[model samples]
Target: MKCTAVLAALAAIAITPVNGGPIAYGICQTGCNAVVVACYAAAGFQFGTVIAAAAAPATILACNAALGTCSATCATVALFAPIP
Candidate 1:
């Protein structure tokens, strides 16, 4: 059991940034919102509303590219799994 715990800890460390770096929001998150709004803006929602919905929090897991892999700092492990 102890060995398993140690291995889990090591894996966690391996995915983390050395000093807790900042991450940028994925472009897809923004782009999807833009496209949706552009396609349906006449339905009552304004461009600003779409922009507001697309706006990410001040702090978010920024996507980073590293040696053919994605290395990112995020609030949750699940957040790090997907590239976008």
Candidate 2:
């Protein structure tokens, strides 16, 4: 299911802070990366352009916010370790 990628991307935006080690860092990196990508994909950027570019501004804006939020999450996780 290709659509399953972003199925819960937005809902998974909020992540709790947890003191973790290597494994946690790996999960954080992978998880946050996936969420951020899914956020953009949900915003219709996956195709390299906006599909309904002007159809729903709110939805696209929400996705944009989600992108920022999820990217912040990635930054937060980066502090967890060297997520490179």
The prediction achieving the highest lDDT against the true structure is 2
Clashing pairs in 2: none
On the 0 to 100 scale, the lDDT of residue 36 in model 2 is: 50
Top candidate when judged by TM-score against the true structure: 2
Instruction: List runs of model 2 lying over 4 Å from the truth.
Output: 1-56, 81-84
Tens digit of per-residue lDDT, candidate 2, span 1-84 = 222233235225536534435654355456655765676676566523555656646756666566556555544544443222
What are the candidates' C-alpha RMSDs?
13.9, 9.3
lDDT: worst 10-residue window of model 2? 1-10
lDDT of each: 0.32, 0.50
Candidate 1 lDDT over residue span 1-84, tens digit each:
122233345446665453321222243233334444443543444434334434533221121121012212222332333221
Kindly provide the TM-score of model 1 when superposed on the true structure, using C-alpha atoms: 0.24
The whole-model C-alpha lDDT of candidate 2 against the native structure comes to: 0.50
Could you give me the TM-score of model 2 versus the true structure? 0.37
Model 1, C-alpha of 8: deviation from truth (Å) = 26
